[model samples]
Target: MSSFCPNCPDQTIVDPPQTVYENYYHPQHVQVIHPVEIIRQHHCVPVYHHCVTYTVKDKMCTVSGLKKKSRKRK
Candidate 1:
């Protein structure tokens, strides 16, 4: 895939993984799918202190689709 990360396995991390991961949020075992974008807040770049954002829903993460959803006994 075009977005596959060179560092990680194929069809794993999203193509063009987040670049600001290491530079900004230093998280262990960081996986990225989509590239980081400069979001404009109030006509300026939003301030991201030190943390990465990846929405979790439907037992899958938006960025990295590899993350499994919560396993609950039926």
Candidate 2:
């Protein structure tokens, strides 16, 4: 009645079970809404007319220097 152990030194009694790869991340809660469109452009305000005419022997006449009209804010 003996399972061989006469001062035992034979190596390998139990060694076979290894296959491991781990990466775990779970956190999901998402609500996304994107809608933006704004376009408003209206420009119509420009009227300037200045006419001067003189005939029949004109000695000397000169008038040129007028540019100061810009104020629009509302």
Candidate 3:
């Protein structure tokens, strides 16, 4: 049995440590599972807005439930 290192969990060393979770971290140890890109566009549906910014994945929604696939039959 052995304990993992806080700085190098995987026992890997990276130069010029990258910032992870707002802290300095090794590139090899830290991974960006979900990357969100900012996109600005005008939206009128649902609501009207001049400049609307949205994430690339749009995974920041607060509502919880299964996403609808298609409109229901009348």
Candidate 4:
């Protein structure tokens, strides 16, 4: 569910519940991914990727589930 501001059409996304696992990995070849939070700060979109933070403005703010692009071979 989202909450809309009266002065603007932008919606505020709510954060999900946090869960803790005692042991999420095994002895070998284990991988884990942390959840991310995204929201509109002023006029820009704040994206959190681990310890790094990025921003997207205007219409680009509407895009979701983005990842870094890889270069194509010539």
lDDT of 2: 0.83
lDDT of 4 by residue, 3-58 (tens): 96568577789899899879775578668899999986777678877786799777
Q: Each model's C-alpha lDDT?
A: 0.72, 0.83, 0.74, 0.79
Candidate 3 or 4, higher lDDT?
A: 4
Q: Which ranges in model 4 have alpha carbons more than 4 Å from their true place?
A: 1-27, 43-74
TM-score of each: 0.12, 0.22, 0.14, 0.19
Model 2 stretches with alpha carbons more than 4 Å out: 1-33, 58-74
Expressed as tens digits, the lDDT of each residue in 1-74 for candidate 1 is 48875586556555775556445656699677997899776766789789788987677537765776798999
Provide the lowest-lDDT 10-residue window in model 2: 58-67
| Number of the top-ranking candidate, with TM-score as the measure | 2
- What's the distance in Å from true for residue 17, model 4? 55
TM-score of 3: 0.14
TM-score of 1: 0.12
Q: Which digits, one per residue and each the tens of the lDDT, describe model 2 over residues 1-74?
A: 87986887778677697889898989898988898999898999989898999788757755669666899998
* RMSD over all Cα atoms, model 3: 40.6
Best by lDDT: 2
